[model samples]
Target: MPIGILTTDTGKLVEIRETITLNSDAFSNSFHEDLQFHFNNERIPERVVHAKGGGAFGYFEVTHDVSKFTKADVLNGVGKKTEVFVRFSSATEQLGGNDAARDIKGLSVKFYTKEGNWDLLCLSTPVFFFKDPIHFPSFFHAMKRNPKTNLIDFSMRWDFVTKQPESLNGFLYLLSDYGIPNGYRKMDAFAIHTFEINNKHGDKYFVRFNFRTEQGEEALTSAEARAQDPDYYNKDLYNAIEKKNYPIWKLEMDVMTLNDIKRVDYDPFDVTRLWKKGTYTTVPIGCLVLNKNPDNFFRTVELSAGNPGNLVPGIPGPLDNLFRSRRMMYRQTQVHRLKVNHNRIRINEPLYWKVYNRDGRPPVRENMKDAPNYYPNSYNGPVPYIDPARPKERFTIYERNAVDLEPAAYFYNHYLCDEGQRQRLVNNTAQSLVPVSPYLQQRALRLLSLTDPQLGIRVAECLEEALETPTPAPHAIKIPRHPYEGNKHYVHL
Candidate 1:
């Protein structure tokens, strides 16, 4: 049998050239055109956040029934297994950045169910830096490298966190030993935001999703993490899956009713605050086991885009400000990076479906054929799902305090039971703030002091030791022109 001949993008075969020369004529060949196309279009824009990542194919088995909470078919019965692709990433870095850096780790999962794709986009930490979505850009910008010097600016970060005050909870976690996980498998994951679930009877409940690592939580110290390979976490996950030692995470839910929201001291919808375990019953619904590694990392892992908005029926999200912003941003970013027809990509696409979307750049599937693309046509068109019988869901969120430093202070003083861990947190935070302007340093210290007076004084002492001088008095410093400006260098003894 003859091998298949190569063709151009338009499927035109090349004829034998009578006279071939290594000149301008060589560029006319479709082969050359194909090569140029491939070369120019090899890379897509990396994710705005969670850029450095590793992922695997997995199965999430519903071990326990939660039919009363959600009408989703995947969780309706025990022993049911849904195919999933899970991606673990560092939240604040580019593609080539270190995976084990002291940053929040993104844990996103795409479940390919018969109904549609359901994504549970989560983070390693339970709470986030800010509760409002409007501050999203500013927060990221602060965490990112400085524009002028192209270096990580600790002062910019400290300025933003100190000013916001609400970010203390997350700042505390990010500075603790838990900030750097031993590997993806050793880390627990949280939805970080509340979501709503509906039952067959149309009953609704707000819940926070938690995925506890079966491997047990383990983290590396700053020195220990820096000593290992930057890609240590990625290698660990890949190697473990290759050896059939699959990593497992148990799916747990903290259920809260409408009445429970009023009972809580903090805003239930605030991503910056966590709901205590005692406030709601902990129920285990399923377990995820990653048993297969991606054959091509770039294709299967890098190209996969998971969004919280890609939810199936029965699993709907709340009206949380951050959640709404994320839903919009996720769609926009994916479209910008992967093109309008991004969902058609193999890794991102569902098993089978016919949607109204059509005729975009490099569409992979059928162009909807002769079906009526427009909705509300008498000639037969898909109709939106509506259930009037469902009870109306309503709730209220009052002005919760963001400036309260109690959480961070409490975590530092009581949560870190080990004196060594508490000392490490203080040292890490102080070292990070060393390069910042004294004004910003004092501002951050003031916020920390609100958390605990002793904690603040200790951090101040550590900052003084690192700077080899006293922290500048807050009222004496002059403001800079640029809003986010910082000191270049700090004097050392």
Candidate 2:
């Protein structure tokens, strides 16, 4: 094969010496047009959260018929396959951060169905920090580095957790062994917010989706995670795909009918709480298999966008407040980061789409080729297809102002029943809490005590053993008033 000539971005062949100027006087088009232009625009804005991630290309196969629950074509026919792109990320880590950090993992899947793209955004934990979206900013701020010190402050995290009892469930999950997975292949993903699905008969059902790892659950201890490579999970996933050892997850759902919803004692729409174990039926949906890795990590994985609001026909948008807030937040963030025409990016583009949205940025391919951009026009333009099976009425949610800890209590007393697991949880919690102030630590212990006295005692013991100096006496420990204590309707459990 003949060697190709080095050229500028505009395709002008360049001599070797033209790449560099002899003195500062000479102008080199090859250096300016090729090297400088590419270097100046190589990076985009980093995500505020979930910045460290790896993605892959694969397909989702429907293993079972779910037409009765959701008329979504991707889940309707058995053996049907839809091309998919999945991005696995750490929740609070910034760009170039350690992949093995102890944090909530983000598992976002984008299904390229014939109808359009469907984005399912999920986290590693079954429950979230809080139900109300109002607390989102504060919660993230607590998890992030402190503004003053520009360092991760455990005191801030413990303070937030101790004040907002609703965060206990997710806080426990984070401090437990589940916090750090061995790798992305061994982790499970949960769509924490409950979604509404309708069928061809207009039968509505409340559902929570889970992607259980087929490789079985495996996690890394704190020491092991700290010792591992910075890009441990990303490398593990990529190497596994390259070696044809594909990672697979079984898609399942805990489904609840309208009657079941009314019969339940707890609020089903709360993202902070989990649906009771025996209250809902768990049904197998399908399997997600990732067999191919991205050829270009930046173009394919980094550029990919997944938003929860990208729903197909059968599966309507979730009505929960958290989901409602996320629908706007994700789109707005993507627009700010990737621009208005982000959907046109090759990795995020759907199989088929027609809309009145026209040019705003570059890569607006063809701009729909001068088609009728305005709706209600005399020309033959695309029209909306109304589905008769779609539900017309919105699902109603009764509001409550209570901080329920039964979920966390149940998790500790029942789920962490094993002595070894409980001990590990205590040790993990104590290790993180050791750096926090004594007042914040005492408040955290009080919060844990509200969940389970034995768990709190064990963690307190662990903390004392880890600390060199003696901790403040129980009588001397003065906890400040909780932020929500003044609320008349706020019930702390």
Q: Highest TM-score among the candidates is held by which one?
A: 2
Best by lDDT: 2
Provide the TM-score for each candidate, comma-separated: 0.88, 0.93
State how far residue 96 of model 1 sits from its true place (Å). Answer: 0.6
RMSD of each: 9.7, 12.2
Task: Please report the TM-score between candidate 2 and the true structure.
Answer: 0.93
Which residue runs of candidate 2 sit more than 4 Å off their true CA positions?
1-4, 23-26, 469-493
> What is candidate 2's local distance difference test score?
0.90
Model 2 lDDT-worst window of ten: 24-33
Window of ten residues with lowest summed lDDT in model 1: 15-24
Query: What tens digits encode model 1's per-residue C-alpha lDDT throughout 162-279?
Result: 8888898998999998899999999999998888888888888888999999998999999998898888999999999999999999999899887786698766777877776568
Per-residue lDDT of model 2, residues 63-122, tens digit only: 988888999899988899898999999999988888889899999999999889999999
List runs of model 1 lying over 4 Å from the truth. Answer: 1-25, 385-389, 396-402, 468-493
